[model samples]
Target: MRAVPRPAILGSIAAVLFLACVAPEDRGTDATNLRDPWAIRAEPGDPALAAGKEIFASCASCHLADAGGRSDGTIPRLAGQRAEILEWRLRGLQDGSIDLPVMTPFARALTEAEIRQVSAYLASLPRPERIGSASGGVNERGAKLYHDRCRSCHSAEADAVAASNAPRLCGQHEAYLLRRLEDMASGNAGGAGAARAVDPAMEAIAIALSMEDRLRVSRYLARSECD
Candidate 1:
């Protein structure tokens, strides 16, 4: 047997020790991939999601390596969310119907195939925990508020009416929907209604909501209802 250099022998021993102590997923990353201080291990591969993985490259830039959203809440969550809903939103984006400036570029940049790929990947990821199921949470006042103020423009299509560009509210997360409502109340959601800033009625809807009233209404909307 040949004698190994002492320093080389010690280095090899150290490398083996590190691997033994490391988790399986932490191997094989390069420096660029390591740029994000928050990189993490994703769940085990789902053979079905292989397609989405390839398509999601564009979105991974903003949504992050993990489906988890950013701290500022600027981007909506896509992971673990309903696939159909995500597809519809993407379709809206691709078709140039949704208004937010930030999203316009993303929609325009992605191809139909790419959209399907990314949307599929996002759908396969897990949903946010804040999206809890609706139970005993209906409030008559909120329902009436939705009907009287919101229904004219929003129309009646499940919890949310997307036909009039009102957006379907069914299956939306309680916390997310509520946060949106709060934003609307405080001049935050930006668009008024339908055609993005054309509906003045949305202001009335926002005004009707007192802090508690808005909350109750939000909870009622969260209480899963049939379209």
Candidate 2:
């Protein structure tokens, strides 16, 4: 992990404590609309950016201070994500459209302004180097599976994450990818309470793969280069 300045880190921690003391009314309303993520563009060092960094202290535990997330893929890299995508996903989580175990409630805790601010902060950071495969080496079977099943959307170069509005697979952690695939394949990847177009699309794709294929593809992606 990259070393961060102690003061900045401490300030972020303090912000978390401050947010805790804020009453429900002071916390502001939950984010409900994702259609206008660019409603506020906060540059680094701006007041919005500063506030966002402070509020993000609570998230650092899981996402890491640099937002590099875990190399094992249990969490995703938040750094370098598009602000629009972050806003959209957070809104979905806040409203229960996306039903992650921890993120659901975590999203609920933030006000709309804080969410946009943090999203801006995350988008400002540089993307990390590829995490590489947990399996130690590329598996040909996995590569083949990706070519046939995933390449259309992810692209052969695997650099179309933002263009496709899909998650970054290249440089992602294998274990995390594996677990998510398992969940999607098993029809347990969230939105269990109601139907949503996004949830079903992924599930349909995952359902076509056997467990072995899923493992192979995930490992292949974990080791693949983004360029």
Which stretches of candidate 2 lie above 4 Å from their native place?
1-42, 99-109, 130-133, 160-164, 194-197
Q: After superposing candidate 1 on the true structure, give the runs of residues whose Cα lies further than 4 Å from its correct spot.
A: 1-50, 53-99, 117-137, 152-162, 190-199
lDDT of 1 by residue, 1-227 (tens): 13222222111111111001111122332334322211112234744367567555544566555554433434334454434334445554444443445444545555666455554566556545444344355778867766665555444533323223233344444455556556656665544322332233554566667877666655565564432
TM-score of each: 0.49, 0.68
What are the RMSDs of all candidates, in order?
Answer: 18.2, 9.5
Q: Which candidate number maximizes TM-score?
A: 2
Clash counts for all predictions: 6, 0
Q: After superposition, how far is residue 37 of candidate 1 from its true place, in Å?
A: 40
